[model samples]
Target: MLLVMTGIAAFPWPAATAQQKGGFRKLAPGVLTVIPPDKSSADELLHGDLLEVTEGLSGPPENLAWEPQRSPANTTLVERARNRSFARDIWCLEFAFKPPRMIEVDVPAADLKMQRKRVWYLVYRVKNTGGRRTVVDKDDPTKFKTETFETPVRFIPHFVLESLEPLSDAEELAKYRAYLDRVVPTAMEAIQRREDPRQRFYNSAEMVAKEIAFGEERWGVAVWTDVDPRIDFFSIYASGLTNSIRWRKRQGAVINPNDIPGSDMEVAMESLRLDFWLPAAGGNAAEQEMSVGYRGMFERMTLGSRVLEATGWPKTTKSNPAAALERMGLKWGDLLEPVGGGGPSMQPLEKVLTTIAGLKDPAIRTALVREMFGDVGEAALESLAAAAAGPVDTEQDKRRRAALQTMGLTPEQVAKDPYKSLARIVGAMDSQPGYAQRQAMAFKCFGPAGRRLEWLSKGAKAARALAAMESIAIDPNSVATGNAQTAFEAVRPSISALADEAERRKVLQGVFGPRGPDLFAAAVAVHEGIDHDWVFRYESDGPGL
Candidate 1:
């Protein structure tokens, strides 16, 4: 049995006594390599050289080996690191198995109900390690910083098997041989046909949508730079891996985290590359440092299949807020205060009614009305009906009006509401004579002269004159203003097919003098509430027409 230790303080390593410990080796000032204590049971199949602690380091030392040592109480190992400017300290507390032994079972055939693979497990405990308080920038809300102490734990490996244990019993050996014979060739063929795990890793839903959760089912790699630990803005990923070699390669072109994905196994894996990160507006000082140098630390834990299954670490199940609310028969409006507080509320009623209109599910809307308002449902319904009865003058109405006008429509035919406007436009287009009449009606409603008056009201005399002329050409009856003759004379030549360019210019100049175009532009700009300088500014070509 593996020895259990407890209640240890930070930084327990002394340089002189380090070598005497079973298999603790110092790789760097604050980094140490730990090995399992039961050396006899550990074996070569474990790939000792590829142990996570030694290989996962940023720059590991060459030509160093160590034996596994039973940890003293609480802390498994503590290492102290220092450079010219700062110091780092790591404290490791291990939670080893109760038995600290492997299960002995004959290898199962591939066709067996229980198919097993030799997969290693690792765990990481990432925390804020932020300062006592946070500092916000006065000028910029997005920029902020924090103070942090205590060096982050760099590398902790749960596995450093000392040696391999082989099947020695005759019956066990026979079973192992038979299992291999039955499975190896099939396994090789399957491997050849299977899609590349790397492709799946990159294309995984979790990878594309970098969402991480901090819950019981978290597996794989979780990295969060800006995390507020106090509010639980931290993410976790749990994964089973033989080593970190592949993960290290995949870490670049890093997909930044937005929110936590609710599901695990979104990405398929030969060895899981589960990844997600929690986000906060601001980041911890230590995390910032680690992120800058790609130097974050993670925890590693080895677990037997049975132990993992018992702990419920197999897959992540994401929670659905909408479904949850539905199951509770609750609406968002129910949680919000009324439009006007203290007495009866209108806001929730308004929101709930509006939302209900679009929902297809009868129960969704019914439950919203019955459950959300209950006693006040009648009052809410009355208010909603009143609001719906009023004139259609919303932003949507304005957009529909503008759209119909753009498509050569008049108010008479294109009534209020998108459905009516769409129907009118479609009806007008279905018959050529109806389309021509609609066009004529549009011209008559705001023919060139009337359009000119509108522009002048907005301060665009030249544009008004030009538009007024075009309208008259489309429909002679469009000129209905008191200055009808003057307006007609202004654009008469431009309307005539026999008029030349010079004749049109003379008519335009007579209606609006040489400076008319410039003044009209300024007037239009002012009417629209746009910057006058932007309207008048000249580009490389010239002032825009």
Candidate 2:
């Protein structure tokens, strides 16, 4: 028989033997001593009506190694002597089982109607060491820094048992062996992956806790009787190992009491907690019935006193009388107060205008607009164009305008179409210093829809003008086929006009490539009609080049 009783106790020093007791035998500086009930005289000590200390700092050392050769492991205790070796005069306590319990058993039934099976149980205990409090000061030795201390530890006793019964049929038994062969290697691989000792310990604890409570009382025996003839016993055990690891990994990730709550901490904790328990007992398991109970208890016991008091909902504190007049959803600059005299607090909605109007800092304004209106359509585009035309000399404004034009609106199109509200702002780009940039923007926008090529082609400087023509010809969806043909016709006369072969090849490739085959063919015809000494190389890797 194995019996173990472990707890903490403390007592006052006797005046006569005070010197012999070693002056309170400091467990900690102000903390004093921790005494344990005599292990040999436990029976007499209990009957002595001695003051039983339910809680204290003395039980076992905090750090101890388990020796396998020792018997009745619970009886082994390790302790550290009080000295100046520690920063705060702390001591460690450790307990271990020397002769580990043999918990695996095979039972035989005398009657044919009774079932025979194997049962396994693993038993272990954990001891929690209380933390300490201290005071220290760097600048002033007299003025000490005070620290509150408490042990945030709990001891848990655990046992696990698994019952295995042989299959009644030969076919099912063979299938079970085959399944085990395939799964045992994978189970070993998972076990090898858990490198942390704490992880391994916690996993073992969770399994023992779960197996001991399966389908009986919260703490009771698990039995498999009148065994099913078809169930594969080995496969069930093999798969259980894999499932147990998954359960442990998930449990380890949950937020315990050691975690501090933040603004979203509760929500995150609840989510992880729920996720952890979902596979166990199928999501509706009671708190007491799940692994979270022990973890939750530890958290509440340690940190519950420090939890912040909940306050009622906040009352609005704005003192301005006009604040009450503001609409609930009205944004910061949505004209909540009248713009001039009493018209409406806000303007009539036509489009989604960005509120960052006339912002002096272009980068700040662009960022604000992007934040508020990146998802808005034409109104945001018009507002950005207007901002670009403002006095601010910001590169962001130039980029915004370029982006707007690339989105497909020419100044003329904006002027003539129903979306002509921002016509003046769109037209202003033509006269801006970034004319080449504007022309490129116009080509990108108009070329795709085949509508604004004429305006793009009529642009300012020679270099920009040629580049605009190239942009239009390369557009896959360019609608101005005739204008594209005309531009190619105009460039054909200068193909061999004493220019570099690379530039000529580039132009030829652009016209003849995938983007504009018709234009390329037209250029070829014009070249052939002039009987120029131009050689076109066409390579065929297949039947059709």
TM-score of each: 0.17, 0.15
Worst 10 residues of 2 by lDDT: 267-276
Model 1: per-residue Cα lDDT over 119-168, one tens digit each = 11122222212111124567887764343332222222222111111122
Q: lDDT by residue for model 2 over 1-545, one digit each (tens)?
A: 00111112222212221111112111234221122111221111121110011011132332233444757544333212111111231111122111111111234457634333322111112222322323457788766443433222221322211112123211110111211111122222232242222222332323344322111111111122232323211111111110000001122233322223221111110000100011123432221121111112211211111111000000111111112112122222222122222111112121112223334465654454333323232244543334433333455445544655654644344433322323333343333444355455443333322123222111111112223234334321132233423433444455535267655544433222211222233325432222111111111211101
TM-score of 1: 0.17
Question: How many clashes does the backbone of model 2 have?
Answer: 12
Clashes of each: 26, 12
Weakest lDDT window of 10 consecutive positions for candidate 1: 292-301
Positional deviation of 366 in candidate 2, in angstroms? 12
Model 2 ranges with Cα > 4 A deviation:
1-191, 194-211, 214-411, 415-545
lDDT of 1: 0.25
